[model samples]
Target chain A: MMIDHPLPPGSTIGILGGGQLGRMTSVAASRLGLKTHIYNDTPDAPAFDVAAAATVGAYDDLDAIARFAEQVDVVTCEFENVPAAALEAAGRSACVFPPVKSFEVAQDRLTEKDFVSGLGIAVAPYAAVATLADLKGAILRVPPPALLKTRRFGYDGKGQASIHTLCEAESAWEIIGEAPAILEGMVAFEREVSVIAVRGQDGTMRFYDVVENVHRGGILDTSTVPANMAPRLAGEAQAIAGRIAEALGHVGVLTVEMFQTGGASPSLAVNEIAPRVHNSGHWTQDACLISQFENHVRAICGWPLGDVARHSDAVMTNLIGDDAGEWRQNAAEAGTALHLYGKAEARPGRKMGHITRISPKS
Target chain B: MMIDHPLPPGSTIGILGGGQLGRMTSVAASRLGLKTHIYNDTPDAPAFDVAAAATVGAYDDLDAIARFAEQVDVVTCEFENVPAAALEAAGRSACVFPPVKSFEVAQDRLTEKDFVSGLGIAVAPYAAVATLADLKGAILRVPPPALLKTRRFGYDGKGQASIHTLCEAESAWEIIGEAPAILEGMVAFEREVSVIAVRGQDGTMRFYDVVENVHRGGILDTSTVPANMAPRLAGEAQAIAGRIAEALGHVGVLTVEMFQTGGASPSLAVNEIAPRVHNSGHWTQDACLISQFENHVRAICGWPLGDVARHSDAVMTNLIGDDAGEWRQNAAEAGTALHLYGKAEARPGRKMGHITRISPKS
Candidate 1:
């Protein structure tokens, strides 16, 4: 069916990838009287537990993607790495949010950095390394104390290697299987923060408060809202995110991670951008009036964006793996909201759940 | 498979209804990493959209109820009117919250009043009126400006009639289709309010702040938290609800609607009790640290009750029928949280959704 903007209640939203993000987005859609049809390669995807419908198929299966898309008014993704071909297939049957351009730019490290820097946003100095010859030359420009990240299919510190010096570059590249990579020179940053922003179909944009994020083992450990930064710096981060969204003509929630140098005068450099909801924005679920997941559903559905104001300061801690076993204690704690993805196993480093502790803003 | 107290994440909660309450409760269950299997009589029940599994069967279908219960670790009802036999069937396979006693008491108005009044709690003076002769005699004891309501299967102001005077008693009784009914004398009250309270499996109780309610066309129009009452009176209301919950040895959330008489010394009279999550408590979803639905899930799962502290003041307005059409306007309003049940049609008097507008506490 041909659907109009601001898809009415009862309209189905086709979601690609059925992980915790999709689970949350499904819940948000349900809250708005909308239904979600989740498409994932795995049968026991986390989001399937909350969606109205589910389709299990390979991401590159164009027929399956088209069939899934045909049943919904619009399509969106829980993860940024959705195959371009899958999104293209979905686009033939349903409107897709964040647009194909946004995903294309985000799928590669070099392209993402180039896109953001092209918008006049500050980014860490970086150079592409496609071969051993390229690596030798690129290291001179983007030197040691840097990261060699594969251009695609990298997440949670995987497909990445650290290069501490010129001599270690080759071994570091070998560690990542010598994949085409981007060499990003490390910045002397004291804090890492992210801006969770959303753009509506009408070009309206809303930004949640910048959140300070800490990563442990390359997975988001905790995110504290109202990042301990000057308001001016936070606003600048939001402005940079807005510029990126505008340049991409993006719709739905877009999260931009940044590195902040600490001192009397701190400067921010765009680290990366997630074309979907980011783990760092999970704190909004408990601290703000509207959460990133809800806003994403709103934006993708072509509805008006909600107020993204925080009511309290919050620290959201991920319960990776066995940490979820302490749920009883977390449940008993006052002022803590515990959320767990219904994953049956607690594999090491897997995000089993999260808890957000909120206190009145100072 | 046996389940222990403080049911672990991934446990299935079987809900016995599939309306908006069930939908929201299912979402809450999902947030805690719990799955929900909803059993409802209709195919298009709203809760099915969010549930992990759903069984379409009559409420009194013992076989179906048992089958659904067997797959779940625990059972709970979204509405109090669930048949006693259904609970019995479910109880055979899984633990049922609020217990059959709670449902039995709440099913009949006379039994409910007697049960509450027996605990030294003030309830509206009421009398059983099974026939015209009974109505005549009961009206003499309870008097006019009273309500003649069916003893069972009454909800949203249905199965009720108002008796303005002695002569209107017969007509009022006829209005209720002469079902086994009760005659309740109206209290001279300044406001209507309700206390949403939850009792854990261990008998621990937590009460949300009393909320003032207003009805239009016999349907809940709005519920304002921190009801305009003295703290003392609010405490009294909560204490009264606690007493009822304790008396019933209730588990999960129980709501008590009350009539508060105005004067130098305000007094509260129990209007009725709902043995499940209630509509008036919808504000908690937006304004409180933990909502009634989440607490209900926590309580029934044999987990510790969450903090019931309000972070902001809120007014929750029900979107009865056509009111949901203005979702765009509500969505655009700042500080407002709109929740729409995925109902396909907005028939008059049908609860389509609700919007909760919150503000910093005074």
Candidate 2:
């Protein structure tokens, strides 16, 4: 499944998930004359509306996954939670970007912390807990004012509980369904930021400007480019992301979320990593010459990466639930680009759309 | 079939052609959470690769066109050559943009010339030639050094012949297959330029910067925004396009191509009009907040028009036939955005792709 040359314009890239990320990636692929085939279990997946072809089958269905892979020249994923067996099945038929090793580390919270720390990177103190006795030991080592989170299948503040005192460890574990978990000592920080980096098959790397993120109710609320941080600190954040990509032998787009601690001297600590296109990089769609989704397609297809420079400073706001109801107002506003995902329902906490407002750099 | 309200997300737009314009429009529709169903006579049409659904039927198939229109909330065409009967069939089932009146005026060369002149717009002097006697009479009125072109199905410099002398009139007429034609006296123009204008259902209008175009072998080679002209003349060009749009009661995007006659006082003569998204506006995809394709979707859907302001100056070069072979080199160049149409072959004179380079506005 090793591709020695770039895939031609008509080749198809098979995608593992069918959400907003997949939908945007499909549009990017079309711009480059490439075709996309989406594989998702849901019948009405948003990505299905734009992809050249689609397969509605379970991720673990090895036969179906292999067939989907066989039809495409290469394979990539929109999310990291895709099962290892499915990726393995796809690998037998087509080359997969960001390799399975990266996904393996990103899928498990404990493994990701260990991987980042192993590279001599900054990470909050953490300990693994599989039972009540292990939780007690972890609380003693990691201390209170910590978070008890499931090792896998957690997103958007889900599958997590707060332990403010040692006495709350048992209840916090029960709240997470007593799953295999990790206790992380929360870092008191001033701001949260993310670095979006892309690596080509040739090992050439490009990093977008550090993006400052604000979260409400644990979901991304807004992402602004040219983060309000010193240039030296931004460089360090990008360097850390570069080291992670190099260590994992990652190809395509990878995102690193970090916490910035404020004091007399500021510093950054690795929070987590996502092995695919991320929500925090959505502002690039309107502000930069090449978007993260387009770069992902170029990287996976073995094409040269494009310019990462921004033409204007931008702020991207997410549309959650009823927030999408204000699309008319957003559309009427000048200099605003509104993007709505074709979801039938705007259930509470669901991401329905996003809008980006750009202005000349100050 | 009149749509008084904006179509909601997840609504379908039926497109009548599946060429590059339709392909790009479909991608734009997807960005707004809208789905597209493409109808083309060919099975492997470029647009079908990205649409939610597709129907392969002839334009003359009234029943098929009606059925296709019935499945969508609105209907639009990518090319003006679509049969009037086909649009009529679609209009019976759904609201069609750029209305049939505009298409009727655009489809016939003689009709378009008379319509423009009737509206007090400058156009090349022209006479209809339906018979050999008409050509003899037209030669006296229109004079030599004129173009005798077919009234229908003429594009990209096709179906045209030049008459440089009085004796050449009959041969020129025979060269165009003796179809109903028009003989337009040639004007000594210094440059070719175009204006892309969009009109909304609410009678709002927005105009993009005038673009200077270069043609090679009768097909567009490049389009540069901020056309090299006096500010007053550019404004005049826009005003002329606005008058035409108003006269036709047009909705959606319309393009008016003009010839700039060089002299102490440079004046514009209307060359022709396209009642749809056009090639000259492609630069907006990278240089402006909203592209012509996106704005066309908004106008046809009864939504507010977007800002037409550009953040950068751009030069767009087309990749025709063998020119696409330089894609690797183009990809390596910084500050360039390359777009390919997903066509399998690179036939001579075929538009395979385009590349645009942008820089901060001067």
Fnat for the candidates in order: 0.98, 0.75
Model 1: CAPRI class: high
Per-model i-RMS in Å? 0.5, 0.7
Model 2 misses residue A270 by how many Å?
Answer: 0.9
lDDT of 2: 0.93
Q: In candidate 2, what are the lDDT values of residues A1-362, reduced to their tens digit? A: 55799998899999999999999999999999999999999998999988899999999999999999999999999999999999999999899987999999999999999999999999988999999899999999999899999999999999999999999987998999999999999989989999999999999999999999999998999999889999999999999999999999999999999999967699899999999889999999899889999999999999999999999999999999999988878988999999999898999999999999999965
Q: Tens-digit lDDT track for model 1 on B199-257?
A: 99888899999899999998999999889999988999999999999989889999999
Error of 1 at B129 (Å): 1.3
CA shift of A239, model 1, Å: 0.6
Quantify all predictions' global Cα lDDT against the true fold.
0.92, 0.93
Clashes of 1: 0
RMSD of 1: 1.4
Which candidate tops DockQ?
Answer: 1
